[model samples]
Target: MTERHHILSDNAAALSDDAYDSDGFLIEEDGDDTSRPRLYDGDQLEREERAALRRVAGLSTELEDVTEVEYRQLRLERVVLASVWSEGTLEDAENSLRELAALAETAGALVLEGVVQRRQKPDTATYLGKGKAEELRDIVIAEGADTVICDTELAPSQRRALEDVVKVKVIDRTALILDIFAQHAKSREGKAQVELAQLQYLLPRLRGWGESMSRQAGGQAAGGQGMGSRGPGETKIELDRRRINSRIAKLRRDISGMKTHRETKRGSRRANAIPSVAIAGYTNAGKSSLLNRLTGAGVLVQNQLFATLDPTVRRSETPEGREFTLADTVGFVRQLPHQLVEAFRSTLEEVADSDLLLHVVDGSHPDPEGQISAVRAVLADVDAADVKEVIVVNKADIADPEVLDRIRRHEKHSIAVSARTGEGIEELRQLIAEELPQPDIDVDVLVPYDRGDLVSRLHEEGEVLASEHVGNGTRVTAKVNADLAAELAAYRA
Candidate 1:
């Protein structure tokens, strides 16, 4: 763990060296031109020559074994990243590639190198142009890389073609995100949802067996098969597909059951009229830390993408002592896979049903506006556009003041907070109290001394504006929900 942290810190430092300019493009470093091709020669090189070139480029040829297998053994993957820029500034392209590298690291991969090609659009067949694809093949062979990850989701043909040319596993951004979710999911429902998404993704990309799986079967007289084997044998691909389909069906049923249970829980919360405030934001935007800061729930806080996949609900009180539930939900990201969104709908419904959304943003990130836009896109997809939102710029301790000021100017109700240092937390709490739904009824009641629980409930669930002791009991003037008002009706003053 310490070693991983050190590696992550080092990577962060490397990423920070390049600064974004006014136009959001990285100012090319002194004595370095990004326009110059990393590979100069137009001719294909021999094996040794390609290896030498890779050595010069500092490429590594190590395959990170995937650790998400049933055995749960820890493994590290070494990967090379490639992206084709169809329409974006060089800096925008670089940022996208860097994000992919971060995702790869979160999935326990050591990033070897990242390469981008300027093009009008990704090649429909190979993602990169033919010449660039060939160049990539040589780079893969020289670097000893076993996998190449593209920055965008690839079509089935594109994936196959890239794999064929590079002679390595080829995956896209969506697959990488899904793998990270698979690693972090802890709860039964989380696990089920991730598995369902994986199956859905796999179902479409499942490869068919070639000639080896197409051999014809013979009858018993030919001594090649029995009565049941008079025709073509079941291809391995077919059997695998059938098994996957069965598992997918089972997962859907299981997820449905989980959804029902979740709805029941939500229904119970509603019946009690406890207002729910859901914390949501881009992945690694300090949401878990914020939740911990607010409620002291002590959730797992990691500086990695999609670190917390399971939802955690913790009880909290506003400054007025009005109790509510704060739910830490799964974070969103740019281009979050559709399969994951559909599969985790039940969990996301928690966000959709919330009385308020505390949309946290990493004010320190280079592209805070982009993060906000991406999160909003996902929220719209889940039909949560109508839900009330309170934009929160967290990590104020380390954020750029200019960025914070800009965000605050644009978002009137936004607050700058540092969950780590406790800066602006009290103000944030007060703001939450002010924004939350207030009690609808004001009541004056005299409770019997024996019914002290009602008074306690009043303090915990309502805003007790005033209180006094009377001979019969306690006289309280408070604003509360309908249920509490009904309970206090018997002792109405």
Candidate 2:
């Protein structure tokens, strides 16, 4: 009890007071009160729209009796966070729990209390040891919490055991994250990917009990006196599993079609030789803010974790007039579920196929390095590790100077910038331009007036160094990829 009290006090003190503004959003640093443009207003409108759809407390209760298997939806209201500190220092354990608390809050849970148990390893059956589970039950009861969210992904058996001990719904880190994705997914492809991930996570954890779950026919055919029940059948649980498997297969097919569409679009970009830059970072690390700043993307910029699940691609131009596509991707997190990674593989392909990656890090976070490592782990999983990367340490205005210095000193090709105040943004832009793949062939060409479209292509797919309208045609000097240069070979000046 004393240790629990200590843990609570430490975590309470560690919580950020200034992370949110009065409206419960990441403090908007854009600084204008009355002069916001239409795009900025659209960003605000998007956030308000999400706010309107937030889950209401007490509305998510499941049936009292476990008659059949149900999707393990997060009952997020009034949750007590629990963790097993099997390894890492007390500080590390505390940090992990604190992160879990944030995750719960983002999922619209009111965190009532957080507790950690010291163990060499998590208990196989209950996650927390049996006695510790009882202690957790006491904490849940004392706090009147409706749910317990474990800090790790629990096995199905472990979740059931913990629920039996605590007498409340128990969810794990994976489910909590999945819930966030479910809430934030907007695009058709995004929704399908999230559903696939949820089903994958739900399949093994499905549970049922008693005669209600038995769908096998028991009638005259089975030497029983019944007429309505005589039929070929499987157990209810098996039927449910079959249905889920069917849905999974359908989702895969639908996603495959969407992937083809996406690939076609990507192929068009490739055909034009336009470079791509992907913004990749930890959840709520200001990736969207950076995108809005860089490209005027007008994406919803909420402070919550996984606030933006759909990848947004916007056309942007370098300071030197080279055009490219900048994509804001779904943010990464510590222990991002493998199910999501597998489901979102097509989406993540944007990162893998990009010419450059702007690896954004929240410079203000306590463990910026950890965030970087987690993001890189996901990137590696998607085979995006070899992409040229520029570490953009964002939120420089509020970041600790020491932390900023540490990150800059440690990571090569890193630049510290505040996406809000525009501090160091030009430097970041210059860095990005330098890191982006440059066109190899330089061409000076003169084309007839009828070939104006070629001049347009020269400006779009290549870096136009000089251009002029001649009496007979358009004269252009540019650096371009080999494919574009070959097209202009006939008109070489």
Candidate 3:
């Protein structure tokens, strides 16, 4: 079934006093009130609070099972969202929840209902307070929600406690995001990295079957059939742990190999003096759309979050025909899962290694500024902080004029453009051309007729404006990078 989310009005009220059952499981408020758990009204919260909650209640998208080595899609889960509004205004909290709703949608869940409670800090045990959790449970029950998605990452104990109370599966922001990555990963290396990250996350969360699972029951008496399996008969959980560890190692090895290949390609580009630019931003900020706009890359462009996982690099040139490469990389998000960061490090290096970064932001988003900060936070993690940036405020056709003004006021070098309509593309291109690193030297040189290779090298490694077939050789006038300028020094005219 197609995925859909329900955004409640901002004025909806919270659950009334009589909404709970004797056992405290949520059930529908209007249904027969038996001793059994009541179904949550699914709209217990006030219109405003409910509006703050972008509950993805109806649609179900397939999810990948992280526990398995092979990629497998699990049944879509029905999820309810819960968030704590400790800091920021109600609008801010609502926006955060809205993003969460999008994430849940991306993970293939029908968001049922969302709730938020005002708290200074999350409870150390339940994330939500005990009372709030019960209320959440009530809502989950009422809606028949199979899963509860928290706005923040939950500690293992916290997660366990929440599950015990809600009687449903619980996942935090990190896991939801990692699941999305696993779903979108397409390439061999991308899959390997995602799996490694999943295992790393799963290793610590693995539940053993008590002390019996920890004890070694080796030898023929224990039904050990293999030569090496005699001394250490592993329990089911132990075997799973071992297998995951082994897979992690192999994945690292595979990723390292892929990294070496990437480096080789980067080296070749460097040798040719091709300038590289990388596009990065918050998830679903239109990075792929922008890349397609600039290069006609025809990459996948979807309305969903994290629609593109693998990096795409295509050769593109400026209006002056200065050749450079444009790479579209995985988008960042607020509190990006650390495991993903480490696993995708090699891929993100494309951004760090670029001569310029086209930081795209959805000017039309409710909080474009927040998106900027989140993307920068991840970029800092990847050590791309020092890379020159040109903030591209995309979606101008639909963006709020006030928001665009706010962006332009604070970001002096920012440009507003609509990637969909091609508006302001020329100005964006010109800005990119101007921001890109320029050649170190411009000179007129005449190469000997016999050494045509040098003339060709000049074209490859420099920006040649004019070349002529002179009596002795080809006369070339061009702007050359420092490396090539040195090589052309002897031929300078």
Candidate 4:
């Protein structure tokens, strides 16, 4: 058997059972049953509902005898993480496995154990070598683990080979992430995009065995099967693939339509010259918390990865009363599935089109720099690399001072802030105001009293330097966009 090892502390292996109720809502544990009912908004209620339905442990129904062409659901329970250290240091491999553990937990699985193999490269036939694979099987059996999650994306053949040896279901990082997205996606577009990515990932990996997968249909071969089974037909796998393809096509169309609606809203914002700032970073890096801190958006804030899959856009104002929209986007991760990037291209475009990006980083993480690199890689994939960035080192209240100093020193336009404790938030706000796009055209306009809407627009869409009321109308001097400048041309003073 593989040597017994604790990938994480015992506390990290399982979440505190008392922290949440059976419905997944946080309940004060003062041992009082007579407390008032906690009030939750719609979003919070939906999130709690999703959490309540999370997969239970030891409930996975995957058959042990089925090795080939098994249809696996992400009903992960009692999982063992496996990784091969090819290039990075041993610490890096451990960190990767730890992250995998967090991911499994986020997907509602209990992490039993983890193992890392020091290989120059992953084995071709099996992810781990033959001996190591057997050892892993032994570990799984000993720990009663039903799933083995590889740290890297596994090819179909490799996954099959690994499962055959391990005698249990095996999945990769990509599928695990996809499953989390599947569970957390709430919006229609978000759900559709996630389904599209899942189908894309599943198409190439579809496999089958035995005559049941065969298309052959005749009197003897059918074994007294009815007339419907007598004709030359496509295999079961083929039918499933075709259905998935059809669903994918329809999802694409639906997502396309939704994309157009999103673009129209964006176009309206552009027309109004409202600046947009997208909060983006690695998963669980406090992007949503920061959004709430800045805008009181009250988005779902959980200590789990990929908790916020649907992008939330909220209108916010800078300290100077200049209005801009802040978008909380889907968090990026290392090796973010390309299928997801393609599927969520429309949503990611919000980042690409933003006036600025608040790249939040977890200052407490051991490998913050690595997380930054991974996020940037995905940003490049979405063509958002060129957008202006303000590195916001979050969790400063609990972060290592040396790590915070290192990050601030390395990033030119970085600020350290704590979303939880409200530390350095004012400085972050000021930094954002400075980094956002500024209106260039200076306008001095005298508007009629009947055109008060113009005055409000001036205050909402541009920086009003000065304003005064005259007998004829209200006179204002401000900097505005070209579009708004044209609207004020007739009233120029």
In the range 93-193, model 2's lDDT, one tens digit per residue, is 76777888888888877776777766557889998778778878887898778999998999999999999999999999999999989988899999999
Candidate 3 lDDT, 1-493, residue by residue in tens: 3444443344444433335556655544344654445444443533244233344433233334456312322455778889887678767877888789889988878676777675556889888777668878887888778999999988888999999999999999989999999999999989998999889988888786576565465555555454566555467787888899999998999999999999999999988789999999988889999999999999999999999999999999888777889999998988899999999999999999999999999999989999999999899999999999999999999999999999999998899999999999999888888888887689899889888888877876677889899788889999888888888789888
Residue 311 displacement in candidate 1 (angstroms):
0.9
lDDT of predicted model 4: 0.84
lDDT tens readout by residue for model 4, 89-109:
656767777787788888878
- Deviation (Å) of 276 in candidate 2: 0.7
Minimal lDDT window, size 10, model 2: 49-58
Of the two candidates 3 and 4, the one with more favorable lDDT, higher being better, is: 4
Worst 10 residues of 1 by lDDT: 1-10
Higher-lDDT candidate among 2 and 3?
3
Clashes of 1: 4
TM-score of each: 0.83, 0.82, 0.81, 0.83
lDDT for 159 (candidate 1): 95
Give the Cα error of residue 185 in candidate 2, in Å: 1.3
Clashing pairs in 1: 60-143, 61-143, 61-144, 64-77
Relative to the true structure, candidate 2 has a C-alpha RMSD (angstroms) of 15.0
Worst-scoring 10-residue span by lDDT in model 3: 45-54
Model 4: which residue pairs collide?
Answer: none
